[model samples]
Target: MASVSMKDVALAAGVSQPAVSYAYNRPSKLSQAQREHILEVAASLGYPGPNVLGRSLRSGKIGAIGLMMMDKLSLAFADPCTIALLRGISEVGELENVALTLFPLNNNRLVGRSPAANHGSLALRGLVDGLIISTLPDDHPAVLAVVKQNIPFVVIDSPLVDDSFFVGIDDRGAARTQMQHLLDLGHRKIGVIIDRLNPDGYRGPIDPQRFKSASERIVRERLTGYVEAASAAGLAFEDLSIIEAGGLDSTSGQAAAFTLLTSNDVTAVVACSDVMAIACMKTAHALNRNVPQTLSVIGFDDIPEAVQLGLTTIGQPMVEKGVYAARMLTEQLNAPAGTRLEPEQKIFATKLIVRTSTLKI
Candidate 1:
């Protein structure tokens, strides 16, 4: 096949080389009729216009961004909460005409690929102009690789990175509110379930010392809030048991629930997510333990399924967080080369939505 060049289009349209270039890239430099004629001639010659690589190299921008996550893309989308966040991100990406690339480090393992192997490729290949980390731990290998590469990134709901933008909810205050609800109901025997204590999915009773990692910032903050609220009520950490779920899904929630229910006499349970709360409710139902009667459950993230199941949950603006994070990244990308913008910490508020899943115990 013969390759069509700008020279061919210029000769066919009777325009200079610069005029042909202007017609495709700098259209304002040419009259409307001249630009239309040049495009029509280029179409006739089977020219597909300039290569993306050529355009990107000339502009010093890729017109795209990458989103990093440790979980599989399929599992990430399964949760409506994550779907909401993706929706917000796509909304801005569509409006700004930017593409989004997902990097799920764990799934790549099946094909003998590791995030470390790809991290270097991303830098050398220029896969994206910027990056957004959804929920990597503070010291995650992927996070470390990105930091080492000095890529522009925003951390969402994880360890607060120095000189990096962060977007998250006031998890501690929100957890305290939910814990107070259960505590106010005369339920001192409360249990807590965290989706992740460490990146390894270590389930079972979490050691008190294990809660100090910045990687578990969200979990630590929420537990701290619960402890503070309990202390204000003249209660101690010994009054409750804390367990880490096996995974981020409902099965993990079920396991955590069983351990808490069988091991202790908890009248109420607080889960870190509505998905986990739903799983605990199912486990309770299977065990013939009536909800709000034998056990009351409260979860974070008021996902659509939570409303359908009448689950009492904490509502956070997942979509808004995504939107704000993407906007900050875009702003950073558009900033002057040497301009320094102070890192911004944006915290969204959470609300307690009372539903059938929780009640006075």
Candidate 2:
């Protein structure tokens, strides 16, 4: 097929080559009539509009943002929190006509690997003008991959790099606040369930020594929050068993809860996520334990299901986090080339939602 060119359109429309280019690249340069005539003539010549590849090459942008998460693509979508976050990002993408591409990377693929061993992230080169990565250690391979790319990016569920944008809630603070609720309810023997303790993807009770030396920032932070609150109330950290569910979702939560409920004589359970809380509730039900009466349960991230169950939880602005992060990226992207962007670290607030699932015992 003979691909139509701007020159052909210019010839048909009796305009200069620059005028044809202006019609597409800078429409304001030409009068409306001239722009209309150029469009009409281009249509007559079967010439498509501006070439994407050529424009991207000349403009140094691909009009897309990449969202890289540490999970399988299918699995990332399974969590309601992930969905809510993506919902916010997509809203910005739609408004700006920018594509939001998912780069679902497994733990082995993204973290703890050398930058040279980061094969997965290298694939992102030239794929997106910006990246929004979630939850990695400061020295994670995925984070290194983003650093090497040297593009505008926003960090979520993790710490911010210098001169980059970071959007996340105060996980430690939220965890402390949520755990305090359980403590205030007069629950002395409480259990804590976590998705995972480290990037190694290990499941089970994390050894105290290993937990102390662990690099899993998210897990460590939340656990610290719990311990801090409990300790402040004169409760020893050793009194509570922190169970690593080893995966993301209600199933892992349920399995972990099974161990805690079956063995431990706990009065309440604090799940790090809504899914885990749901699992705890299910486990309590299967064991015939009445909720909020025998085992008061609390969760984080007031997702739709949590609300439906009237579960006491901590509500983070999931969608708003995504929205604001994308908007921050958009600002840096829209800035003139060579303009340095300062680091923007934003921590959204998390609220406690009192519901039927939690009760003063």
Candidate 3:
């Protein structure tokens, strides 16, 4: 059957096409009784009103924002850092009355071509008013798409681009501080675990060459900090046992921690994230190695679990970072059309939170 149209409703209600439009979009243009009568007639005729897409296209406003993340959408809810970040973004989004859309670029090696490679164009083609890019690796092809779209965007951590709004901490400095704490505790042999160096599926045991050329910005900086701290203590990148968790979840962390705890020689362990750090502690306990007694563990991103489990970690304000990134994008969006704002950078400070997970050897 043919769909109901505004013309059909107008004809049934003894009104012109413009009168029907005024009833729905410009109610004040018509008398209240006339508008109500038109609406009732339209409802009886099953006229669903104006095309939202058409209206949005004409107005040049979508009333929504896009978020491009490094991992799969499934991890959005699973990762504590992302959860806190989303909470902050959602708070501002509620006030701004804009919706949030996720465009997770699954960088992990898949059986076939990556889905991000397929749907990236859709995101860049005016799907949302603005975008927030979160922790993408260096030279990600998707970023080129975003730049080509000429859309308003804010980058949250990793892969610092020139002439762009960025919000993050000094990853290298924070990691150096984290490792220095472990070194001060008299730990010589240390194992380090990270989520991934790049989007590739490669996992387990980071070779020195890969360590020198880590592709992910945040990971590279943190690894550099660890290497620098170790070098100061008479160690090199090759001296430390570095393992890639292969993923961001606890299962991946547990696997990496197990391998590092069992295969390599180390008294202390530094994980790039609290999730992996907690996994290191769990693996140590399962192997009959007590935390801070037999094996010391340190983690980055002092998530809530770090406090509950008393895990020493490097703390960055995840929620605040998110809030700032959202605000930056919103600021760009709220500006007059075709007005380009100056690129801004906000580097938050990180602190080393000492907990019971580490010991003074």
Candidate 4:
């Protein structure tokens, strides 16, 4: 049997070869109706469209985007916040018929090579048209490699770089607002549980310098916001009890909550994420402490579980951030050469979602 070609599909559809190519490679170049007709005709003729690999080589454009996260791919799928953001990105990618690939950092099992190193090499080699980086680490090797390659990309939930696009919330302000809710509830002694402060993943008692040099911008900024809010309420920064969770999971949350609950000074706990807040609530239950009545708890991200648990939280537009980030990458890819693809840094507002977890003393 003979294989189908662009010309065959074009002739069958009564369109030019370029029109057929535009239907698959650059749908934006043709009118919606025309593109739909070309696609339908090509499909009817059993033409699976152009070979992505061959088309990419010919046109210098790949219909795919990469999303790089600091954590493992499994964890990314498990986290509600990450999942929401991914769903948003997926929606945009679906519209453009673009594949969104997950790139993990530090694949420890791949001999001596790191996943970050591998992903960086691929980015530099132009494996994907663009990238959406969701990690908070500023100096990540993967991030630096992408920047060095001069690929169009966007950073989500992280600090804005002059050369890259960013879509995120004001972490410090969001943290401050959430923490203030606890303070307003007459919770003078509040404890905080956070993920690691540095790339080294040190557990427990992060020093001032380590905090200052935190690779995760969100963590540093949120910590600063919490400190500022606590200070305004007459609480000294040093006086705020802090617990470093090894990771952003319920197990770590439980451990941090146990430590904080055992302390005599902490009457409230502010978890950096909803997962941790839920764990804290579980810990409170284990300790026979009534939430709000004994220990008020607040969280960030306002994941669905937070509302179910009646935990007060700071709600940021996670899905919207992902959508905007994906859209920015798409625009960069479609833009003309020498066109400044630098999208203005977009900061979504965060609102305080009050619930039953907090109450005035």
What's the lDDT for all of these models? 0.77, 0.79, 0.82, 0.77
Identify the leading candidate in terms of lDDT.
Answer: 3
Top-scoring candidate (TM-score): 2
Which is the winner by TM-score between candidate 2 and candidate 3? 2
Of candidates 2 and 1, the better by TM-score: 2
TM-score of 4: 0.80
Candidate 1 lDDT by residue in tens digits, 1-361: 8787667777899977656656654466679998999999999889876443333445686777888776777876786777887787876632246677777756544212444665655532577877888876656666666776777888889867777899999989999998998887888888888888667767888766777753667777888888899889988777768888857877778988888788888889988888888888988888888897889999999988998989998999999988888766765564434556567788898999998877774
Once fitted onto the true fold, the runs of candidate 1 whose alpha carbons sit more than 4 angstroms away are 1-60, 93-96, 107-124
Per-residue lDDT of 151-172 in model 2, one digit per residue for the tens? 6788887745666788888889
- Quantify how close model 4 is to the true structure by its C-alpha RMSD in Å: 6.3
As for candidate 4, its clashing pairs are: 107-115
Clash pairs (backbone) in predicted model 3: none
Backbone clashes in each candidate structure, one number apiece? 0, 0, 0, 1
Model 2's lDDT to the true fold? 0.79
Candidate 1's TM-score = 0.78
TM-score of each: 0.78, 0.81, 0.80, 0.80
Q: How many backbone clashes are present in model 4?
A: 1
Off by over 4 Å in 4: 1-58, 93-96, 108-120
